[model samples]
Target: MANTKKDILTILGISIKPGESKEVNFDVANLHTSTPVNVPVIIERSKKPGPTVLFTAGIHGDEVNGVEIVRQIIAKGINKPKCGTTICIPVINVFGFINLKREFPDGRDLNRVFPGSSNGSLASRVAHKLIHEIIPHVDYIMDFHTGGSGRFNAPQIRIVEGERELNDLAKVFGAPFVLYSKHLNKSFRNTCAKLGKVMLLFEGGKSFHIDDLITNSGVNGVKRVLNHLDMLSSKFKVSVPKKDCILIKKSKWKRAKYSGMFKASATISSKVLKGDILGNITDPYGKFNYFVKADNSGYIINVNEAPIVYQGDALFHISTKLED
Candidate 1:
């Protein structure tokens, strides 16, 4: 990716010069009560010009882990880069966030509508405004997310296969696992890719919950990336990852075979062999118990955490192939 350095950064119709700080409102609409909502876009620039990176989270309102990750980045002053610019948007779906839900007020997933039209649904309009007003100002993006309800994900980075630059950056971020995944149509990642913007999507923990381990993983990954770009402040130190990142090329979900109360014995990021006892599903009456086994030999990337599950619900996500 080329450096999108500018002497003057203009975002949301606000002009911020080098070495300036500004909090611009990214709010596109008001609440039902006619009250104004504040979806802040925090931008910090260094005196020296370099690359501009955006840190975004809360695309899904219930993904509090992602929101906490970005919150820590801003709280610790990490967003104040030593060079270039850093823009942080801790919550994108303000409607969902306010209601503690995942979709907009009209029940549309914001992630599904990208590059939206000016006269569209509330979610689509938000997407349209973000793509037009915010995306063009940054060269790189790190969007944080979490697994949907009841599934706990090990800290990982997701990117499309065969993109050398993205692969290298993912390595620099140094998460535990790097999953080679495809871009969904009309998603933020796809829209950014189409517009020639490089993005690294970070997924960790589970929705509606915040774990310190997950938060640290995300915050540390941001530091590593900033350090790699030579934008890290001298006050912060980047730590080397304890283990090498596992590059997963293919994976499959192991679903429950029976409806019952479930408990996972295998932990996230643990290596499991074929037919290993991953967890157990037990009937409410305790009359029967079914043990769930691994389908293949690989690392466990995601584990379902819901206490009660139905047959065919995904129990675990296991890696089937890895890159050498």
Candidate 2:
């Protein structure tokens, strides 16, 4: 499996009143020249009281599908939802975002340091600021992501194993599949869960590029989850049909055997049986090619398209559910 409702929203020293909405830019960091960097947040309080849902995107900076998904949500307006408040932070790592990198300029992955120390590295400080100000107030969170550069991901929801409610929400998301994964230490997903908060991570498309196929599906999934949880007054047209959501317990990644160009035989979401040739890795001149066979039957959730590759480079991500 892979992985919201509303509340009174307050952050950046601003307190939002019930039945109202406000957008605030939070000053969290500074430049060497004393320039201030701000995180943009939109808080909409429902007329009726309920749980709060935190929608976070751009944590990796390069991943923009989440950014677009959140942007459209704010643009479309889910104000005065049936209950609770929707707090949207379209971009968290402002530094990485402008740099188009996943880590801070000082070189730290923000996602790896959670409930961060107040007086730590730049990444830690930023993580601390966000966790202290945001995570505690929310009942549930949706962290968005996309494949790293040069990789394409099949739209899917990944959640930590064994949370019944979270599992249900993942289904409501209606992605092509659901992946149950173990939590990464200090990651937003793990930290939130450690604090007893329910969260989901949505991964799709490729980083940096705007893949509308992922963006649209993400928007609809978020809305569908909101409606399913009774946080929204309306139901969204779930992009993927309910019947299409396949639940998977595990996945495997296939790596390139030799440095060369990769010609893939399977696209994202295409299923293949074990021993099938998922792709071929060959030299630039096509002098010789090695068949990258499928180790397990499953859908090809991710693939690399870069013309050049180094040995051991991940060429495919297989999402599989083994036979019972």
Give the alpha carbon lDDT tens digit for every residue of 216-269 in model 1: 999999999999999999999999999989999999999999999999999999
lDDT of each: 0.94, 0.81
For candidate 1, what's the RMSD?
1.0
Q: State candidate 1's TM-score.
A: 0.98
Best by lDDT: 1
Candidate 2 per-residue lDDT, tens place, 1-324, comes to 111223345677887877888888866669767888878788887777777888989989898777888888888875346777778999988889988998988898999988788899888988888888777778878888999968998888998777899888998888887888899899888888888888889999888888888988788888888887687766444345646587778788888888887788788888888999888888867588888899888888888877778899998988766313
In candidate 2, what residue range of length 10 has the lowest lDDT sum? 1-10
Error (Å) of candidate 2 at residue 292 is: 1.9
